[model samples]
Target chain A: MKYTVIVKPKKAILDPQGKAIKKVAENYFGKDIGDIRVGKYFEIESSEPKETIEELANKILSNDVTEDYEVIES
Target chain B: MKVAIIRFLGTNCDYDCKYACDVLGIKSEFVWHEETSLKGFDCVILPGGFSYGDYLRSGVLAKFSPIMNAVREFANKGGYVMGICNGFQILTESRLLPGVLLKNNNLRFIHKDVYLKTEGSRCYFLKDSNKNLLKMPIAHGEGNYFCTKEQLEYLKDNDMIVLRYASEDGSVDEDANPNGSVFNIAGICNEKGNVFGLMPHPERAVGHLGIDGEEIWKSLLE
Candidate 1:
């Protein structure tokens, strides 16, 4: 099975890289987007069960204090 | 005390740490990250560098190294463990320390000397200073420390905040914060005060310009 996980900084936390990207995009978009939040995507392939993959994603793939994660596809 | 500075695949600060220890009159050794045992060492140091190419995130991949288990065990036994720069990131990922290093507020790598003010505690890695103010160099991109407000409060209430960014005259304020770290924190210790992590490279500032990093190693004997 392959799991696609999306992780992003917690909403309350500051995302400098995301902000920088947003600034650049604005120069080209002409203020089409409101706020830009940057995040990372991970795809993990494993033969293990869903529970195991979920556990792995929770433990190693994301840090709860600063980032949030979700299993987008499995 | 014998210090074992663990060198991960991309660790570049191992020699600098070793040299700093030598300057403090202590013999140190560089141990590869694959070792499973840290039995005889009194202190373990994870030096700065682009460990594991800083792939997924700074310090993320390196935290899973085989040597980290031994480092954790050593820290659990009350042995001193210090992590600098990328090492600090690894420690936080391993959950040895709280919080995470976010991208710099300016979204750029900062490599310059800044003043550090030690909080009013006599930590093992601290305590031999002139009013606890010293100049140290910080070189990293993802060094903006982030944590929950409650966690920040807890760290402050417990004196876990070891060092913070400060002005040249040792005044800590918003203007002195180089990386937007909460509470201007540049370094912190675990609740037990055994494990330590800092974003600045004390080893890099040891032998040159003002020579403040030596006081940290010299405090090991105190």
Candidate 2:
């Protein structure tokens, strides 16, 4: 089995890297752009159950205080 | 006091910490991350570096090291534990300390000497320090600390905040905040004041690179 996990900074927290990239993107495209948020994507292949994958996403992949994680079974 | 400096893969500051201990006449030794016991050590120091190459996040991977279990047990037993720079990140990641360190507001790695205003009343690590304002070097990209508003209030209410970025005259304000840390926090102690973590490299200061970190390292003495 393979799992995909996506981790992103919480909505309330300021994402400085995303903001910097947004600025450059707007300059290059020369158009008003909506908010740009950056996140991490990870793919894991394991025989572990989905619960274990969720736990990994929650415990190691993302910081609860600053980020959120979603585990997708594949 | 005997100090055990915890060394994780890519931890480059362990030697500097050992040197600091030697200069202070404090017995110190390097304990690899695989060691499972923290026995016979009065203090544990986690020095700064890009542990695990900061793969997932700074200090995130290092938290799973075998030695961390010993560190947690030691800290829970009320033994003195201190984390500096990247070590600070690890403490937070390990949930030994509250909050998290985010990337700098400017999205840049900051390396420089900054003034610190000591503020905690219950920190064992600052008990012997006489200076309220001191200059120390900080080098990190993700040193901007953040926590929920409720947690921040609790930290303030409990006097857990140990240090804040400040001006030379000891005024703490937004201008002095290098990485946009909440309330300009540069260091904090656990609720019991035994476990302390800070973004600045106090060991590097001890009059070697520049400035005297005596206020910090000296306070660890028995």
Best by lDDT: 2
List ranges where model 1 is wrong by over 4 Å.
none
Candidate 1 structure quality by residue, lDDT tens digits, B96-209: 999999889998899999999989653568856555887889999999998888989988888899999999988999999998999899999988888889998888777653
- Residues A11-53 of candidate 1 have per-residue lDDT tens digits of 8987777788888888898885768888889888878777886
Q: Give the TM-score of candidate 2.
A: 0.98
Clash count, one per candidate: 0, 0
Give model 2's share of reference contacts: 1.00
How much lDDT does candidate 2 score?
0.92
Candidate 1, residue B47: lDDT = 95
Error of 1 at A47 (Å): 2.1
Query: Could you tell me every candidate's TM-score relative to the true structure?
Result: 0.96, 0.98
Q: What's candidate 2's DockQ score?
A: 0.95
In candidate 2, what are the lDDT values of residues B58-120, reduced to their tens digit?
999999999999999999999999999999999999999999999999988999999999995
DockQ of each: 0.79, 0.95
Compute fnat per model. 0.77, 1.00
> Each candidate's interface RMSD, rounded to one decimal?
1.1, 0.5
TM-score of chain B of each: 0.96, 0.98
